[model samples]
Target: VESISVKKIETVEEFKDLKIQKSEKGRGISLTLPPDIAICEECLKDLRYKNKKKYYMYPFVACAVCGPRYTTVNALPYDRERSTMIEFPLCNEDKTSCVKEYKDFNNRRFHAQTFACAVCGPQYQLYDRSKNIIETNSIKEILEITARRINSGEIAAVKGMGGVHLICLAEDDKVLEELRNRKKERKYKPFAIMTPKLAILENLVIFSEKERELLTSFRRPIVILGKKKGSNDGILSNQVAPGLSSIGVMLPYAGIHYLLFDFIGQKSLIYTSGNVSNLPMGIRNEMIFEQLKGLADFFLLHNRTIFQRCDDSVLRVHNDKVKLIRRSRGYVPEYLPLPFEVEISGALATGPELNVTGAVLRRNRVFPTQHIGHIKSLETFNFLKNALFNIKNLLQIEDKEIEFIACDLHPSFYTTTYAKELAEKYGINYFPIQHHFAHVLGLM
Candidate 1:
């Protein structure tokens, strides 16, 4: 391993003397941008602690090591000004002392770009089917009322860090059946359920230590675990996973999720991506409501904009190792290293049409985009295109440096067509890789 010399500065002046050197033209090095981190234990404690006045019950509590990274980022060099959090400016001195916390090195939120308190940060609001806001005294009241509605077997479109989720009761057969019927596209596919705690999930699914670790880890990906023998009898409706022996489960990852659980009576609730009939998941407020019409009885939305539409990541543990099904949300914008240096200076690969994720390779590291569902429709195709553009922008990879574009061999595949278009636009070479061969190459 190549090691660089290290030095410790004893004073502010000593630290101030340090300067960052710019990389050579067309060549640079950086750490892979992190995925959205789950709410830390300290942050969770501050949620209810009386002394933490500004943070008490605050839904947007975040520190440098936690909160959104890829999903909220518009452009990068990764700073507050380049993120969606820019909309929520720091509170006035009278309401909160965030600026002080930002400057205080001893504070957990020191220099946190997404730092904010209830007074100045994003706020949640409940909306009826007619798009009328259901007035509530505070976010707590909103959560309580939302939970009550869900408990009463009503469906709700709950917006989270990345995209909207269609949530409902997991234990009621009638409710599950109705949800399946309403969300016609996913009639028989298993729906992932979110639990407040690990104990509740343990009682329903049989999981290994590895699986448990994944469930509680900072990434908080949905872990598919085998259901215990009587789990489907009553606790969880059989319809939750249809006839499958395994079920996908995830724990509360955000402050809103944790707080909402405080008011929910059930051990778990159905939390699936909010999309209908093969379309992409919803992110924008106006687009979400219209897209999910009649599917959701209410909407538990937030004022914060989602700069990127990311869906919850899904994975499973086999032989004590984690196997990812869909990689998004908590595991994106991160570069995957190749053992050997790449011959090309830079290249972009547009994955197959279904369950696709585009990739941009520079030198030896490949940065994969978040899960960009089916590319059959123009809307979804544009989502993939934008995702590719964002990653390239973040990496500062100029079009001139992209030597080649890769795609599936199928001529009619939308991704293939897009890859050709990109190649033509940038005057780069395009390579059509055989579909199955691409999977084998991934194994390499």
Candidate 2:
């Protein structure tokens, strides 16, 4: 017998499906961030069950409640029109079914914009370094091939919601060594690992209930969990965390990620940004092909165009609240209201070189763009410009705002240079505060 529990409470919101509406800057409804979600149980069921036509053997299958959002979204209101999914229209049969389910208020897929099935969803393929199609149009076959290659200690550049990730069997030293050598990764920095389930995570790390919730939270940030006593022997490679007492772990967030864990039958894979050090991670197929051709043995390429390249969000629980270490992908371009209204209006701050996030103050509220990566390369500088432009539009701050641009006073820092350029373009004043002074004032 199937029954549903219903609760009604008096509120200002009469919600249907996840209705994302385009709101003006500083006044738009900040919905639950698209980042704080993981694979739901029903989708999991669809993956492992016998329903071959619906979700079985499909990698990109997603319902209304899950799958790619911030990465695929090109504009606000978060509709398919504003996303990279505009290219792949649903087939006629799938479109009919989608419309029926969309109009049905009780269905889980009601108005699910990212909804797709085996018959009409995005497809996956496996390719060699030369772009030779190793496997085509078969997620199961791709999984099988990826599993074999990973088990044999080869690196796979697997695509996901936001961007491509470099994955290898976590326990393989030879593979880790190869990855380190190829990427020129430092010896001490640990690579994050993706496990299949919480049970395996429990075995590997000493965690609290909050940490457990965080581990399994929809945001699915990489939680830095302390190592359980005697847990690292043979189960993990020493290279994963050279001298660290904690391990960064996450579970599968997408269907393809879950399928990979199922087929590999391994608990952990060394998951890292699929880019060279000091550069942005790759998102487009051509970008990956060009940037990671020599390093990756097999490429799990997909046709989906990632509208923006967002690295997986990274953070750790501390003192009961999660502290952000690297906020991208899952947590970019979110607006926050000041506890009390600020006296200032229309101010902009270009943050420091490392852990870069720019902020604009509009109508006494602060809206920070998601991490723009290190402001070093020419490409990154352009990204910073785009971020500033996008956030300005989101916050509805006109370019003519007479306020000044604030940035670090570091003589040779690229951010400072960018600030000067912005000042010149906008005919605004440039405020260059000392980096150390900013740090001290920030703490105060």
Candidate 3:
């Protein structure tokens, strides 16, 4: 039996004689899980090395340093089993099979939960809008086809990190008009343009020193930039930014996207969510076929499954400060140390306002899922529920161990209502936190 320690204390009044004793023992090693980091310089060097076994041209060659984080994750405790990696089992050829052990090894793949080789990782496939398979081997071919189609004035539905994107030639007025007409999107909101890189963006838009720095930051968020004076106003349709003085822009973040830019050689391309107006981006093949059949001419798709649907996070530098407009993708999983230590367990926090979700203290680490869009419709609501349940089970948490349930104070929020249902079903204490207060605590 373990021995317990007791300490006596002194106080005033009726409780002066009262004594409190606490037991001290080695609980275990505390684990601190951080949000997935960007691809470190070391890993990038390895990827560029030609002679290395895992070198350049390998699209899936990611290590613990950088890769998918919230997008690929199914649940908390962010283990491989709870991630999209589960779909692609580890290659037996590699001695380090498991993600945990792989991270422990002194290799490039160390700490990379989403790390995998082309042999045992997510793969891509291209298809026409009619669901006919076009190509499968090389993603470059699909990009080539899409680029040609775009140059010829056609909208292409390009699948990306979290969701599908409706891509069209930014410089082609007829193409933009056609897309607008097809979608019937009112010229109220601005569309985000995907540029090859910062270098290309500098040519198109005037970037201040601060703006340049934020645009190239690891988060690589979409930065809204004012149009350059004397620039070709005809390059983009005026409808792209109806009332806004600036345009939203982002650089390519993924290898496939980089390849597309390389093939196109164009400075920028119009990129928007690949879905009908007011609907969430299509996730599944069936959903894509049903929802986006008439909207897109071709579909550049892949076989890898997306556990959660995340939209691109938008940010702007205002009053010399970086303000997050749409928090998703790169800026999620905001890491904050817990105020008090409780049981070594994980919790899934369904964020308030629109549809934001994050996981907390999985192995003492918290990773917020990228911004899931507004959970208004049944389809989006169902996607949110699935994402939550999948993340919970992925962290290997049993139904009973969930001690506390958290939700927003907003009564009309679907997430809040669902959280209440979960609490009732599990007989757990539910804490209704105010949305603004939660945001304040997050900032702290």
Q: Comparing 2 and 3 by TM-score, which wins? A: 2
Model 1 C-alpha lDDT per residue in residues 285-380, reported as the tens digit of each score: 998999887799999999999988999999988778778899998889777889997666678999898999999988898889999988878899
lDDT of 2 by residue, 1-444 (tens): 124788987899777665535544343323333542466888788888864566786777777887777667655655666677777665557444655665566778766666677766788888899988884456677788889888999999988877789999888889988888888755568999999888987778888899888777777878888888766787888889888999888888888888888889956899888887666777788888888987798899788888767777788888988888877755665666766765565878888888788878776567677677887787777667777776675445567864888999986888888788889999989899998998897556
Q: Would you estimate the TM-scores of all the predictions?
A: 0.94, 0.89, 0.75
Report each candidate's C-alpha RMSD, comma-separated, in the order given: 2.9, 4.7, 10.3
Question: In terms of lDDT, which candidate is strongest?
Answer: 1
CA lDDT of each prediction against the hidden true structure: 0.86, 0.76, 0.67
Among residues 3 or more apart in sequence or in different chains, the pairs in candidate 1 whose N, CA or C atoms overlap within 3 Å are none
Candidate 3: tens digits of C-alpha lDDT, residues 320-349: 788878777666545435666656565556
C-alpha displacement of 157 in model 2, angstroms?
0.4
lDDT of 2: 0.76
